[model samples]
Target: MIHTTPHYHRIACLCTEAVETLYLLGAEELVAGISGFTVYPPEARQQKPKISGFSSGKLEKILAVEPDLVVGYSSLQSDILKEVAEAGVDILHFNHHSVDGVLRMVRVLGSLTGRRHAAELLCEQLEGQISAARLESAARDAAGLPRPLVYFEEWHDPIISGIGWVGELIALAGGRDAFAELAGHARAKQRIVADPQTVIDRQPDLMVGSWCGKRFRPETVLERDGWQDVPAVRNAERGHIIEIKSADILAPGPTLITRGLPQLQALIRQWHEDRAG
Candidate 1:
């Protein structure tokens, strides 16, 4: 007789995306603990032991879970990863920042948990969605439709631009990223819009704000000094300024395609329709 099971039977997900991925792979039972910030499946919060936050976690509580492996994302969680690693537990930290990187994360995570086949299937679905969105954008372009210039704000006070994957999503959704040059920077500080006037000068046709878990205030953008002439601000009444929740877009997982992409597509489509009408 031959026996085959996942290499890591007891896993602790310190990021919401990993928890969401495990659940999507039907391996939720393997999850020993999850981050307090998880909210995607909703049931995950209700069922799993909340063990950590994005940048902080108690070593004692994490150790109490006795996880065979712990998974997290980015350098933001490096401190937590260090504590868990010193305690003789295994840790996988991902630092993906682009659409391709996101898909690769799904593939790698699927392989780690013995769900390679499921992950492949999920990837195929996501790829198909990406292709479909691209096709839609191409068709619009073929008809000589102008793509909207989009300004995606990850934060407000410092005026941070969206990340790489987000800029990719904007292009896929038939829009041009207002700050495409800044998107390549892995750190938020690097992507900061140094002067508010820079955004005014960009004259974006759409402004989308995620605000990293904070409530996005379109009025604030509209009220910014000398922003009255910005197309997005001027068209605020037509819904050009919008908010996509952080959980859907900020998390580099399936939700980016499943939830975030669709919203961008709709907003861009509406922008075209409004212009046509």
Candidate 2:
């Protein structure tokens, strides 16, 4: 008898982005629990037990699920992993950056869950989508249009530009990032644009703010005296208020290209039309 190894029965996803990726990778059946912050797929919240959130959560609830494997990401989840592993639960941790990293993660997750073929297929699709966006950007450039200067706000408290994959995605979207120097650094400390006048000096043509999980208030931006000098504000251009959930962009997964890149393309196209007029 050729014994095919049995697939893992119950899996817990502590990271919201991984939950979405796993669902797309044909491992939905194995998902026994998911993070409370998972909002992309409504089904996850509806069906899976709320075991984890952005930071800390009910470890006992995660333990109660009795997951054969628990997935985690970033340093934020390190403590949770230590507890879970000490308790004798299996875990598959992933932390990656750049577009290539995301593909690797999909493949790894697929292998761990016995869905290698599904992972390969998904990776191919994601790469193709990214290629399409790049081609679109090139086409826009060929038409003798200039790219807009972009400032992407990941946080507002100390004023930080995006870090890691988000910064990379901004470049791929055909816009020049005002804070590209801050890419690949830790999220909190990176791109501390402490001087509001520095933003005024840069004179960004477009300002895209995700503001993490909260709604990006354009009026708050407009209200600032230093910001009034920038073109995006004076024209009331309504600088694109992007609501990209942080988990997806920061995950270093296929969704960065799948979800993040396309949104960037759309914004670039909008900029092109605005500039032409």
Best by lDDT: 1
Tens digits of per-residue lDDT for model 2 on 223-276? 887888887677565435345655456545666687777777777777777666
Candidate 2: regions farther than 4 A off: 1-7, 142-144, 238-252
Writing each residue's lDDT as its tens digit, candidate 1 over 25-58 gives: 8789899999998977899999899999888888
Local error of candidate 2 at residue 143 (angstroms): 4.4
Model 2: lDDT to the true structure: 0.77
Per-model C-alpha RMSD: 1.8, 2.7
Candidate 2 steric clashes: 0
lDDT of 1 at 96: 94
Per-residue lDDT of 188 in model 1: 94
In order, candidate lDDTs are 0.92, 0.77
What is the lDDT for 194 in model 2? 84
Q: Clashing pairs in model 1?
A: none
- Worst 10 contiguous positions by lDDT, candidate 2: 1-10
